[model samples]
Target: MKDATQTIRRATFAYSQLYARTAAREIKHPVEGVVQGEIPRWLRGSFLVNGPGQASVGPDRYRHAFDGLALLREFILSDGRAWYRHRFLQSETFQRNHRDGRIVVSEFGTAASANPCGGVLQRFISHLSLVGDFTDNALVNVTPIGDQLCALTESPFLHRVDARTLDTMGRSDLRNVASLHTIAAHPHTYDGCTYLVGTRFTPPRPKYVILRFPKSEEMNGCKSFLESARVMAEVPMSSRLYPSYIHSFAITENWLVLLEQSLIINLPRLLLSKPMGAQGFVSCMKFDPERKTRFHIVDRKTGALHSANIETEPLFVFHHVNAFEQQGSQEVVIDVCAYVDDALIRSMYVYFDGWTPKTRFAQVRRFVLRLQPGRSSVSSQLIRPMRSFCEGGLRGDMPRINELFNGRPYRYAYLLSQADDHREDDIFLSKLDLDSGRWLRWHCADWVPSEPVMVPRPGSEAEDDGVLLSPLVHASDECRRALVVVDATTFRQLAFVEFFTDCAAPATFHGCFVQAP
Candidate 1:
C-alpha cells in the first residue's frame, strides 16, 4: 500500500510540473505586457488578516520590518512596465582586504522586486551591474595591479582599472579562451599567480577546467601581477548530465575538491497543480593535475574515489559548501535549512567523510554533526502565520553561513535567524565539534548581524585562519549598517566600525579580507 501511494504521488508531481511549465510559457507571451502597478491594497492588507496577533505591521503594513512590499509596490507604480524594464540601483558588494591592507570589492547594481500582469515573472533579480555592465560569463577580479588597484573583468578580454580612482588602465581580450568562474589566490605559496577554475558550458557535457595566471609584462602597469598563466587540467565525467558546480572550491596540496549540488523537482500532472516536493544532493570531485578527476565518497572511507551518487536525504536547500581542518582531520561541511512540513528549520555542522566506494562512480557516506540545541527555535507565528495566503510558501530568503577562525581548537560557524519580539534577527556563532557533534552558541547582544567575512589576523600564518568580520545592522535603524569584528573561537565582540553609507541587503557571496602589508 505504501509503495502504491508513493507511485501515485510521484505521478501526480510529474503532471503538475508539466502543467506549470505550460502555464509559464503562456504567461510569458509578450502581448500580456508587463504591469507595473501597486500590488493591490487587497494583497498588502492580506498580511494583516493572515499575520499572527503579535505580528508588528510596520508603517508599510507588512509583518517584517524590511519594507519589501513597499519596494515591490513602488516598482509596479513606475512607468517602466515592460519585461526587464526596471531601473537598477547600486546595492551591496563583497570586499576583502588583502595582507597588504588593500581592499578589493565587486561593485554591482540591484533591482527592486515586482509583480507583472500575467507572466511567470522572476521574484528575485540578480545584481544588474554584474550582468549588464560586465559581459555575460565574465570572471572579474578586482585587486592591486601595481601601485594602483584595478578591476580586471575577464571574459577572454581583461579590462584593468585604477583601484583608487576607478579609472580604466588597460584592456586585453582573451575571447577565445572558454570562460572561467571561480578565482582564488594561493596564499603565501604563489608569489604572483592567481588560480581559477571553471566548467566548459559549451560542449558534449560541461567539463571542469583549471587554469593558473602568472605575473606578466602585460600586467606591469595594469595594476595586478601574474607571472605566468596555463591550463592545469580538464576534468571529465562519464555521466551525460552536466554537474552543477558550487560557487567555491577547496584547494589542497594533492587534490582540488569541488562540490556539485543540484535540486530535483517532481511536478504533478494536473493543470494548476502545485509542486509536490524537491530533493537536493551533493557530490565531491577530486581533481589531481597528474591524474584524471575522480569522485569520492563524502564520508566513511579514505581518499578512494567512488562512482555512486550520494543522496542527502530530507533535502536541506543550501547555498555554501566549505572545507576546513578540525581536530587534526580535514573535514568538509555544508550549511543548510530544510522545510519541515511548512516551516523552515535551521541545521548546521553537517560533516562528510572522505571514504570512497568500490565502483568508480559509486555512492559515498555523509553524516550531519549533531550539535547541542544550537540555534534550534520553534517556528515563529510572526513569519509562519496560519491565516496567510502564502503562509506555507518558501521564504525565498537564502540563509548565510560561513567559517570563522580565532586561533582555537574548534572552528566557529555563524548563522542569522529570523528575529523575534524580544530579540531581533540575531546572530548566533556556534563553536563546532566536527567529530563528536558537540557545540556551543554565542548570541550577539542587541544587534542583527549580516553574513560575516572571516578576516585573517594581522600577523596570522595561515590565510584561512582568521577572525570573523561581519556587518551588523542595528534593529532600530535598518539602514544603519556597521562592520563588527568578533573572536571566532569565543564569539566575543571585538570592534564595531560605522560606515558612512547604508549597506544593502545581505548576500550569499564570499567576501575577501585583505590586510595592509
Candidate 2:
C-alpha cells in the first residue's frame, strides 16, 4: 500500500512537470463552423482575451503564472463562423527582453536586476522610470475606453489593443497623468461613466484615487481615454507604507466597493527580499491579524468614502458576482467567492514541486452591509441576510455578468471553478441563477476553462437572455482549442468553433465580446 501511494504521487509530479515545460503556442488561422442550429445571425463580434502566452524567452521559463508574457487571442464571430487570431503584447520590454534573451525589466512578482545585460549602468537607467510602465504585459482583463479596447493589469498603464487584429497598439500615457503606482484590473462601467481604482503608493503615504471616465469614444475618437478621466475621489489608506493588493472590485448603482485584504504589499520588503526568489509574492506581504478587513465604500457621484466605511474579518477575494442596493431599503447586497486566508494566494507561486493542489473550497457567499450615510450614530458592522448561495458548493475566481446588468440588480452570473476537487488546472463553467441558489454546469473532458464572458442578446428582456462564451483550453493538447457558446437559458452547448494551431493558444484569463452591428 505504501509503494502504491508513492507511485501515484510520482506520476502526478511527472505530469505537472511536463505541463509546466510546455508553453502555449502562437498561431492563428481561419476557423469555420456552424453552431448546432447556427447563432442568432445577429451574434457577430470578436471575443478578445488576454493571458500568459510565451513562458520561455531563452533558457529560463517564467517562475510564476503572473510573470508569463502576455498573449492576446481573438475569436471573430461572423456569418455563423468564427475567425481566430492571436498576438503577443509587444511592449518595449517584451522586445528588449527578446532581443537580450533575458528578463530586462521587473514584473509585479518577478525580479530583473540580476541579469547579464550590464553591471550597473543598465539597471540604473532601467529604474529611471518605474519598471511597471516598461513591463506592460496586460494579462488580466480587457475593457473598452473610448473607441479602443484596453488590456488592464495591476500596472497603472492600460495597454491599448487593436480590437480586430488582437495587436498591442501602445500604452496609454494619460497625457502625462499623475497619481498612480498600481491600478485594479477590473473596473465597473455604467451610465456612460466607468469607475476604476488607481493607487498612489509613496514611501510613507499610500492613497487610492477613484477615477471616473466617459465610456463614449464619440468625443475624442480612438485616442487615450485617461486624458478625459476625472478623479471622483481621493482617499488615503490607513496603511501608509504599502498599497492593498486589490485585483478587482464591485460596483452598485450608487457605490464603489473596494475590499482591502490583509495581504499588504510592502514595497521596501518586495525590493529588498527579491520577492520572486523563494518567498514569491507571499514574502512581499505582511499579513496583519489585527488589521481587520475593511470595506471602503465610496459614493459614485461624489468622493465621499468615510460615510459608509465598514469592517469585517480577514478574507481574500479575487472576483465579485454583483452588488445591488436593495430597493426600498438602506442595505446593499454583495456576492463573492471568499477565501479564509492567504493560503490560496501563497500557493499561486507554483514552481515545480512548489505546486500543490488546494483541496479547501472557496464558497460563494452573500454579504449584507447596511449604510445610513451622514449618521455618526450608526455602526458599520456587516449584516448577513442569507446563509449560503450554493449551499457552500460554488468555487472559482473570475465571475462575469452581462454589461447591461452591471451596476444594477441581476439574476445570472457565469464562473470558472475546479473541474474536480483534486485538480486546480482543469476547470468547468458554472451558471449561477442568483435568485435561486441553483447552478448549471457544462464541461468537456480535459478542457480547462478560464473566466466566462456573457454575450447578451440584442433587445433582450431576460437577465440570462444571451449566451455564455468561454475560451476552453485543451489540457493534454494545447494545439487544439474551441470557442464554446452555450445557450443562456438552457445551459447547453449551442455552438462551438473548433480550431487547431501549430502551437498552443496561451491560457486566457478574462475576455470581452464587442457586439457586431
Candidate 3:
C-alpha cells in the first residue's frame, strides 16, 4: 500500500509539470507573420536597418530552479522543440560635451534563451561607447578650474574621465561599497564646483551620500573622500516592508528629486505568479542646497519610479524624465510605457507645470496624453486579427507604449505594437504639443524598432527640433539590425546605417541620441 501511494504521488507531480510547461510556451511564443495586410501603406517601408553579426552573451542572466520531484516532472513534460534566440540592436545616444564636440551612446542588446519554469527576467546592462570623445552617461562639470566628466559604472568605483579624450583621468572607490546604483552631478553656479550624489546598497538597506569635488585639476589621491563626504540622507527598510531601491532621479537648480521604488518579496515561484502585487511604493524627497536639509517626502502607492517635477506632481513608471527650465518657470515632461496583464499595453505622454516650494505633493496635477496609431491604408491583405487571445481584446486597439525622451522642437515618446501574426514589431514616434496637451504621430515604422534618440541639428538648442535615430530588426533575416534616422519635424527618412549583426532582439530599456558637437 505504501509503494502504491508513492507511485501515485509521482504520477500526479509529473502531470502537473507537463501542464505547466505547455502553458509557459503558449504564453510566450505565438504565430508570426499574421498581420502583414493590416499595416498601413505609408508606414510599410524599410523600418529596421541591419547591423554586423557579432556573437556576445548579454551581461545579464537569471537562474532557473526546479526542486527534486518538481525537477523530474519539468523534464518529463518539457517540449523538446521549443527554443529561444535573440539578436542585439542599437537604441539611443547622449551628448556629453557641447564645447569640445563630444557625444556618447548607451548601447542596448537583447537575448533569447530558455525559460525553465519562471517568467521572463527583466535586466538591463548598458555599454557606454563614445561617439566623439565623451563617455556615455558621464555628467560633465564646467567650471573655472577645468572641465571634467564624472562616470560611475554598476561596479564599486567612480571614475573621473577626460571630457575630451574619453580617457580615465582619476578614480575613486567608496570603501566597503557594494552596489553603486546611481550617480548625479550637482553644479554650483557661484563657485563653479560640482557635487556628486552617490547612492549605494548594503545588505538589507540603502544609503545616500553626497561627495563634493574641489575645482582643481590635481587628483586628490584620497580614498577617504567618500567616507568624509557628507551624508545627505538615508532610508532604511523595515523587515516587514519591501526592500527599497533607487530606480531613477531628477535634479534642479535648488533641489534634487530622488525616486525610491519598492520591490516585492515572499511569493511562491510556481504557476500563475504575480510580481507587481509584491507591494511597492514611491518616496519623493526634496533636498535643499542652502539649508542642507530634507525638505519634503511624498509617498506614492505601488508603481515604478519614473520622473518628477519640483514645481508639479511626480511622474511614475516611465522610461525617461527630462526637465527644461525657462525664464522663471519650469516645464517637466515624461515618456513611459504602461504594462497590463503582463503585456505591453499603451505608452503615455505626461506634462507637469513645474516645481514650487509652497506646493504640496498632492497639489500637483497630471495629464495623460493619448497616442495616435500609424495611419496605414493597407486593408486588402489577408492579415490575422490584431487582438489579445487570452483576454479577447483588440491587440492593435491596445496601446503598446514603451519609452520617451526629447525629439526636436517637441518632446517625443515611443510606442511598440506587435502585428496580429506576432512576427514583427512596429514603432510609432509621437511628438507632444505641450500647450494644447495633444500628441501627434510623428513617424511610424513596420519593422521591429527599438527606442529612439533625438539627435539635435547643428546649432540647435536641447529643446530645438532634431532627427530621430532608431535601430530596428529586419523581418527577413530575423537576425539583421539597422539604424534608421528620421527627420524629427517632418518624419522623413534621412539616412539608414546597416549593422553587420544578425538575429538582434529588441530591448526593454531606453536609449539616448548623442550628436557629435
Number of the top-ranking candidate, with lDDT as the measure: 2
Per-candidate clashes, comma-separated: 47, 1, 43
Question: For every model shown, what is its TM-score relative to the native structure?
Answer: 0.44, 0.87, 0.42
Write model 1 residue lDDT over 274-373, tens digit each, in one string. 1211111111121222222222222211222322332332222233223333334332332223321211210110111362111000011122222112
- What does candidate 3's lDDT look like per residue over 269-378, in tens digits? 21111222110111112111222111112111111121221111122222223322223322222222212211111111011135211100000112221111222222
lDDT string for model 2 (380-444, tens) is 45455435577336676678888788777888888876533345544577888888978888776
> Candidates' lDDT values, in order?
0.28, 0.69, 0.27
Instruction: Return whichever of 1 and 3 wins on TM-score.
Output: 1
| Of candidates 2 and 1, the better by lDDT | 2
**Model 1 TM-score (2 dp):** 0.44
Q: Weakest 10 consecutive residues, lDDT, candidate 2?
A: 1-10
Task: Please report the candidate that would top TM-score against the real structure.
Answer: 2
